[model samples]
Target: MGIHIIKMPDIGEGIAEVELVEWHVQPGDTVVEDQVLADVMTDKATVQVPSPVDGKVQALGGKVGEVMAVGSELIRLEVDGPGNAAAGAKQKRPVERTETAAQAEDATAPAPVQERGADAHVATPGPAQVPIKGQAGQVQPAQSQPQVQPAAGAGHAAARPAGEKPLASPAVRKRAWDLGIELQYVPGTGGGGQITHNDLDSYLARGAMGSAAAGRAAGYAPRDDEQAVSVIGLRRKIAEKMQESKRRIPHFTYVEEVDVTELDALRARLNAQWGAERGKLTILPLLARAMVLALRDFPQINARYDDEAGVVTRYGAVHLGIAAQTESGLMVPVLRHAETLDLWACAAEIARLADAARAGRAAREELSGSTITLTSLGALGGVVSTPVINHPEVAIVGVNRMVERPVILGGAVVARKMMNLSSSFDHRVVDGMHAAEFIQTIRGYLECPAMLFVE
Candidate 1:
């Protein structure tokens, strides 16, 4: 038999490392080519790694939640000689023969019996230790050390009742110990009642909450209960981007209230007419149209600032980013060339992009290369907001909730549909007065819907 080393494969664009989420096989298990070995998660997506050759598993790459770098040895397998003949051929023939002879000679030599250590047991090679078990009973490598039964009154044993150790990998046990958490009390979610990292985290979080509650009941100032969530994957990417934007770009915020009474009437009429033929129209498409029209007049807002190059490149086409919240987190899916699409087309494209983003099927191109961004919370949107500018882009427009408010129109009290437009600009690139004027332009188109259609 010859050994085969499987290295981690590149899963996606610019992915350097991935978190090992689950393993499907363990050492000594027979596997066929294309058999799934593990599921790994990157910032962009989750992918399964499959075995490349039929072989007997020898060892795994790492434990769950561990990050494995691309091109690193992921799995070691023992295969038939013929399957790995090319790899074996690289070894010097003489050296291989010599090593084989030495091993044979040692095997034939008398077995030297040695004294066992005070705490040692008979040593024998066994199936690899399962670090953790999944719902299907599949095991992962736990630790290199062999399992040893603890003696009565020994270290760690004296503190607890004697029994089989908790169903957990060595890594999980170590983490629990470090956090001073009792394993027995932590509920396990893995197969055969195995404790996972998530279980331990949940237990600790609950304990913190309990402690805080008890303190409060005793009339004492309760300690703050803080849950530490790992800033990784998509969340990590968002954090880095937001930090970079705030650090590099000086932001200037502008807020304006637009009396959208006339625009709302126009939108209702259009949706009534085209709602059956095309997709239903929302305020977003109309707002996007207004923004596009406004961009035509003030092209500075539709530009990217290259801080390093010390120049701004403006685009005639608007690659609009619409921020949508998904189950995972916030995602901004771009609607490329928004200026070319009319209101109904804009609505259709917006629906398509939002669906793709929420379903986690958005392409990398669709998720990036936005010249400007528009954010709205619909009913949740308050009267006004100070939105953060999408990095590299000069501005972001926020749409607030539309509400009926009493206003003086031509010296008469009338109820009007009013909404606030909150916008933020890169102060370094745009002056405060210029930023206000850009918002004013957008407001004019929205208030006078016909202006949006005018060439």
Candidate 2:
């Protein structure tokens, strides 16, 4: 048998360290070539580490949630012939171990114990035979005691005999007291009718912990369960990004309601005329068109801010980012050059990007380089929202749920489709008046509908 060592490879973009997100193999498990050994996370991207040679896993390099540096040992395997451990010994030298690590290693090492036969001594649910800590911090097994079998018909815990004194150990008595169980009502399964821990467990497991609790409604039963989930991988990156955006930038939000009855009618007309030849249209593509034309007048809203360099770069081409909710989390996939595509083309590209993002197939390039962002919650969109600007970007526009309500027009009540635009901008770069004006310009294109087609 030969030893093979695999080191963490450098994923590009000058990343020096990556967090170990998941492991596909454990020690003693045989793995084949090209099999994924582990999953590591760098920034928001996840990369899989594959085994180059078939081997049995000897040891894992790190635990999940550990941030390990590039070139660190990832795994050790046992292969058939001479392995790379000997050839690359100098290049992949073992890391220096600290005193704490040595002690931890020794503490987890299994101690030698003799195996017992089935007919020998059987372990009971009591303090006896349980391991206890000695004065030297060493574990010592408690002395064994005599064992007794429960009655053949002891499936249900029967009440003790009327005049016979109930028998039990001090430990069992204390546990019964804690559970508010009376010893006289419990049946003993030990010698001389002594109640054992197993009897108490059986009573609880049979849904009869106590008469009063059993009679209570199941919906109101007391529960003592909890779960702890570790925040790692893409979730951690999102948390960090949101925190950075909130901490560094001063955000100001503006909201405006628009009458979209004419816009919806226009969309229906176009979809009806071209539904067979071209793709159907959604409000998103029309909104994208409105934003594109509006940006021509309000160029300041479509820009990125470099706080460290104290520079703001505005782009002529609108690379719009559409926020998408995926199975994993929130992701923003960019639609390059939204100003060039018509309504149908824009809708097709938006759907394609959204599908790619949801399926976890969005490329890194497709996820970045957006001048501004647009976010919508579809039918779940509520009255209004205060959306956070994507970090380094000046603004983000949000769409709310559209509803038809009564409105007074021409001194008469009429129903109109209305929606609200909730948008936020960096207060350092954009003034309140300009922010409101930008949304008003987009609202103009949307409310009029015909203006979107004009030059």
Candidate 3:
């Protein structure tokens, strides 16, 4: 019998370490070649590690949630015949020793030592070192490494007054300790309810710990009735991106009321004529078409600002991002080349993108590379919203709830369908006056629906 050591392999480009998410096998379990051994997570994606050769599992690389470096020992296995002879030969042969009472009789007698061999075992002096009985019924001493004692009050952040340790990997526990964050308050999203790095990050970002001081000053005790929800996966990604956008970009908002009475009439007529044949027409496509037309007048709004390069690139074609809320989280699916599509085509593309995003099947390309964004809350859109810019993009236009209100037209009171355009821009790149004018351009198109088809 021979032992084979399997090392962690390179999983992807620039992935030096991965967190062990799950293990499919344990010690002594027999596994075949190409069988899955564990599920590891890197770069927010989970990948399964498979065995290369058939063998009986001897030991696992590490516990779940442990971050293991690539090219390190991942698994050890016992296989038939000489397994990886080169590797096995490189292993150290244990040195053996024997003691005799006769030698002790002499005051200066030297201790008798046995020869080093493959069958020999190492020895060390310690109560923790236990003797292992070999196949020949000979007892062999095993060496044990010394354990480091932690200083007093160390890891107090993870300590609980209730005397319960949080379910987390050693690394996560150490990180929480360093940050003075109580793991009891940080929610876990891993299997068996273990805390992950993402959980720690989200907990910190929510300012749950920072609020403690203010609450105490106000004579408020910490609430024990609050439930801890783990922010992980897509939700975690959304939180990080939104936080980054808000932190890096200075946002300026402008709200304008548009009398969309004429635009609504045109959309209804088109839907009645070609809704079944092409696709159902919503206000989104009409808004998108108006924005596309308006972009021609103000091309600066349809561009990306690269803060790192200190430059802005404006595009003639509009790659519009339509924000759709799904079960997973909010996903913005891009409609490429919106400038080329007509009203009907835009509606069809929007429906297709929305369905794909909600079903979680949108391609990577469809989810990114938007020059500008348009978001709407449909029937639930309130009076106004200060929408955040989708970072790097200069502007984002939002559509609010359309309501019929009384307005005077040519000395007569008439009911008009009015909606507000709530838009936000990156103040660093766009001035307040220019941002206002851009919205007015969109307003003109919607107010005069015929102008959208002009050019």
Q: Could you say which candidate leads in TM-score?
A: 2
How many steric overlaps does candidate 1 have?
2
Model 2: clashing residue pairs? none
Give candidate 2 regions above 4 Å deviation.
Answer: 87-215
**Tens digits of per-residue lDDT for model 3 on 1-455?**
88887877888668898766567877768999999998665543456789989998876766554567998777777888788644344422211111311222221111111233444322211113334433323343344423222223332333223323346675675555445455655567888677799988876676655643323431232221111234544565577778978998999899999999998999889889988897778888889988988888788899999999999999998999999998767889999999889878888898899999787677666887999999998888999999888888999999999999999999999999999999999999888999999999889889999988885
Worst lDDT window (10 residues) for model 2? 110-119
For candidate 2, the per-residue lDDT at 282 reads 90
Deviation in Å, model 2, residue 185 alpha carbon: 10
lDDT of candidates 1 onward, in order: 0.72, 0.77, 0.72
Instruction: State the lDDT of candidate 1 residue by residue for 215-261, as single tens digits.
Output: 34322322121122345445655777889989999997898999999
Residue-by-residue lDDT tens digits, candidate 2, 1-455: 78899999988889999998777876778999999999898774678999999999877787676789999999888899998776435433332223334553443222111123311221222223433332212233445423222323334543744434457776676565546444555677899778899988877676554456444453443322122345676667778888999998899999999999999999899989997789899999999999999999989989999999999999999999999998667888999999999999999999999999888778777888999999999888899999989989999999999999999889999999999999999999989999999999999999999999999
- Model 3's number of clashes is 0
**Model 2 RMSD vs true structure:** 11.0
Supply the global lDDT for candidate 3: 0.72
